[model samples]
Target: MVMAHNPKIQEALDARDALASAITRAGVQLPAMDVRTPWAADADEDEEREGDARYALVHLGVCSASVAVLLADVIVRGLTS
Candidate 1:
C-alpha cells in the first residue's frame, strides 16, 4: 500500500526529483541523491508535524573528486552563462 506523504515531505520529494532530472540533463548523475526523511521513524507516517521539523532534507550524497569538479563546473557555467 502507498502512503500519502505529508505536505512538506511531498514538496521535498518533488524538489529532489526536479533537481535530479535537471542535473541528469546537464550530463551529471548524482546516484545517491534522494529525499531523506529522518523523522519518519520517530513520528506517525500520516501526521503532519508542525513548524521546521516537518520538512524532509534532500541529501546530495558524496561523489568522486572528478565528479565534484564536474558538478562545480556545471554550476559555474550555469551562473556565468
Candidate 2:
C-alpha cells in the first residue's frame, strides 16, 4: 500500500528518466523540478494541497523505509530460526 502520494511523484519519475537519458548524452545539465498538484474534489483535498506535498513525500519515504526494515527483520528472524 502506498502511504503517501507525493504530489511530485510524477515529476520525480520524469526526472529519473531524464537523468538516464543525460547519462547517454555528452553534456547537459537540467534544472530542478517544478510540479504542481491540481485542485482536488474531496475532503482529503488536504492531501492534494501544495504545502502537503512535502508531508506526503516524507510519509512515502517513511513507508518505503518501513517496508525495507520489515523485510530485513523477517529475514533476520528466519535466519535465526
Per-residue lDDT over 1-81 for candidate 1, one digit per residue giving the tens place of the 0 to 100 score: 112356766787788889889888888888698766656567776653443345577889999888888889999999999
Q: Model 2 off-target regions past 4 Å? A: 1-6, 27-81
Cand. 1 TM to true fold: 0.75
Which residue pairs in model 2 clash with each other?
Answer: none
| Per-residue lDDT value at 3 in model 1 | 23
Total backbone collisions, model 1: 0
Poorest stretch of ten by lDDT in candidate 2? 54-63
Best by TM-score: 1
Question: If scored against the real structure, what TM-score would every candidate get?
Answer: 0.75, 0.26
28-76 in candidate 2: lDDT tens per residue?
Answer: 3223323333335642755665445432221122235554565456557
